[model samples]
Target: MLTALKLTAFGVVDESTLELGPGLTALTGETGAGKTMIVSGLGHLLGARADAGIVRRGAPRAVVEGRWEVGDGIAGRVREFGGDVDDGELVTLRQVSAQGRSRAVVGGAGVPVSTLADLVGEFATIHGQSGQIRLSNPDRQRELLDEHARPAELARYRADFAERRAAAHELAELESEAMARAREADMLRFGLDEIAAVDPLPGEDDALAAEQAKLMDLDELRELAAAAHEALSGNENDYDAMGVVGLTGTARKSMTRLSDRDEAAAPLTARATELAMLAADLAADVAGYIDDLVADPLRLEAVSGRRAALATLTRKYGATVDEVLAWAASGAARLAELDGSDSRIFELRDRIAGLDSSLAADAAAISAARHRAAGELAAAVKTELAALAMPHAELRFDVSDAQLGPHGADRIELLFSANPGSEPAPLGKVASGGELSRVRLALEVVLATGGEGHTFVFDEVDAGVGGAVGLEIGRRLQRLAEKSQVIVVTHLAQVAAFADAHFVVAKASDGQVTTSGVRSLTHDERAAELARMMGGESDSDSGLSHARDLLARAGRG
Candidate 1:
């Protein structure tokens, strides 16, 4: 709920501060007294477009500030934007410079103007002439009915509709790209077949390289093996030549005799025996290696051919045989997926079909609920219109089948008749400006039932209305304020009299310039203002007497 509004250098309002309270607060003045300026200031404070022209003549800028008793929904949003909110109280400021620049502040922190707009929208609704026109829109009509009827069902249906749309879109793309998918699958299959034919094994490439190197240097390898064998054991062709084994045997026999005479020599004898045994083992292994070192040209040719084959596989699929094997594994897996595209497409189609059936059922339920609510809403609004002095006014909701949409499969339109004999027609066709205002108020009153803690600002919603009709508008507004905060900008004395609080906008002029200011009225002051609103002299006894009677009727005297 709005608690206060302050304006400075804004249009004709040079400086004004309004202290607001619960229930209804009426703002009134003469046609040129700048009541519109108050509405403009409130609009700017709530994040409306700022026009530099709104700045008072010769002023640098126009500033609009407002305070609201907000709930956690708004308070949490303020904090999200790094603003400060104290004890559920929120402050907003909008400043428009004469140079066409604008600035907005919320809860003492700077923010984007839209942020302020969104936060205020959660708790406050501003209805003016434009809002009346908006009511004529078919979509808005549907929204009103949904708000009155089947909100939960509509939400669920929309969710399902969204899911169905996404699935259908995917299915379309998959079907359209069937040829591309098939081409990809063929490419993968060919690559897999090529890799499979090579039949490469892990580490096979490295093993083959080593074997080829050995074959290339077959003579050198054999000579090296022969030398190692002769070093470990004496050559049979040179019987007199001693090698490591013969020398260690001679040393062991000498150490054994010395060790028998002296104990220190015993350790040398054991070392000689160990050296001789190691030399014998080395000699036997070298002989075996020499025997196996025969060079065969046929084996060399075969190893070279096999290495070339492995190289071809590596060049195409990987850098080595192991990498080639890895690619084949991954390729097989991908081929399987590509091969399964038909099944996947089939599955998607089945899922989409199932969702379509489910959505149809959901839409039917929503349509049924809307039809039921259409009657209830029409009845409720009709009753409200009766109280608003539209005794012959009739309202009806026309719910008809439409193609399934995100909202549902129902199209809702409001039909109205202002007299008993006239056939109801679309709201825009039949209702005049005054009738629209009452109808708008009636719909709001019905929809806003139990909507506590919300603020409703009606900018001359009672425009083009007067007399007892105006009084009825005021009574309904007061009734609306029973559950929400209501602020009305009205010129009607009857409406002004019903206000729990009243403010009057008055203008003054010097020889060169004019400015307006607003002030809350005392009980006696309200009487004088109401008299002026009734087109009578403020000091006239008859006007004052009538104003007092209005206040008494409004229960505000």
Candidate 2:
């Protein structure tokens, strides 16, 4: 429920604050006195498009703010957006600058203007001349019928329709790309076969390169080994020159002779013996290495050829053998998917066929529900019209079969007739602007019977209506307000008489500036305003008497 609204520098309003409450509140004033500005201010609070022209001429910006009693539905959404809902109320603020820029704040947190729609749209509905115009659209007619008739059935049908659409989309994609996928599959298979031929192992490339270098210089390697062995241990032809092993043996014998003469020389003799043993072991290892060296051109040729094969794979697939193997593994998995395209396409088609069957069943259920509801709704609205002074008028709902759509397979139209024994025609053809307004009101009253709580704003719903019909409209609005808040902008005294609260918009002007303000009316002030609305001087005795009687008739005396 909207608790309060404040507007500053907006439209003709310099600054105005309205404290609203539950039940019907009527806004009445003379023409051009700026009653519509209240409606415009509420529109801004509801995230309607902002216009710089709406700012007061001398003001830099216009601001509109509203306070609402926060319900669970909206409070949860506020928390989702990191906003605070302190004290069970939510504050929404909108500002429009002269440069056409707009800003919105909700629950004391800045947010995009569009967020207001999600937070506030469900709780309030604004009906104006444009709303009446929308009533003529065929799609809008169908939507209203669905909303009234079979909301649950319609929801189920839409869900099934979405599933069917997704299945169809997948099937179309698979069929369109059949040839391209087949080509891709073949390329992956060819790469996998090439890698399998060499079957390279991890680290094999570097190991083979090292072996190849050694084989290429086999003769030089053997000659170097033989020279080193001869140096470590003298050959039989060079026995006259002592080798490292013979030199160390002579040093050990001299140290031992000295140690026999003096006990301290024994430590030196032990060191000489250790050096002689190490030299002998080194000579034996060199001799073995010389014997192991052998030139084999067959093994060299085989190693070189294997290295060439590995190089070819590295150049084509990866920088190294390990990387090449990784590519092959991933390619094999992808090939499996591409190769199974035919099976996947078949699966999608089967799913689509099943969804199509379910969708048809759901649509049939929705249509049946709509047909039953249409008859009942038409009867109820026709009854409402009778109280509004159209006793002979009839309302009919025409439900016919249509091709499957997201909504359902039913096409709904509202038909009307204003005279007895006349054939009912489409609403646009049979109803005048006044009849249209009454019809819309009748429908809203009927549909809103058990709906969630909302704040309904009716801007001139009594247009082209007066007399007892205006009283009936006012009565109905009062009744509607029992379940929700109602704010109506009207000029008819009969309508304004039923208001639980009344506000009058008055204009003030100096030589160079004009401004408008809104104020709640006292009991006597309301009576005077009603008199002015009745086309008489506010202080006229006869006008006040009539106003008093009207208020009494509306049960407001």
How close is each model in CA RMSD to the real structure?
Answer: 6.5, 4.2
| TM-scores, all models, native as reference | 0.72, 0.84
| Minimal lDDT window, size 10, model 2 | 227-236
For this target, which candidate reaches the highest lDDT against the unseen true structure?
A: 2
For model 1, which pairs clash? none
lDDT of model 1 at residue 265? 85
Candidate 2 local lDDT, 412-478, one digit each (tens): 8889999999999999887998899899989888887765468989899999889999999999999
Candidate 1 C-alpha lDDT tens digits along 1-557: 89988999999888889889999999998889998887777777668887888998999999999999988877888988899889989999999999979999999999888887887777888777787998899998998898888456667777878888887887888889889988988887887788778777789989989998998997999898888777778787998888888888888888889999999888888998898888888888888888888888999999899899888888888898888888888888887877787888898889888878888888888888888889999999999899888888999999999998888887888999999999999998889998998899889888887678898888988877899988888888898899899999998898888889998888999977888988889998889999988999888999999999999999997
Provide the global lDDT of candidate 2 against the true structure. Answer: 0.88
TM-score of 1: 0.72
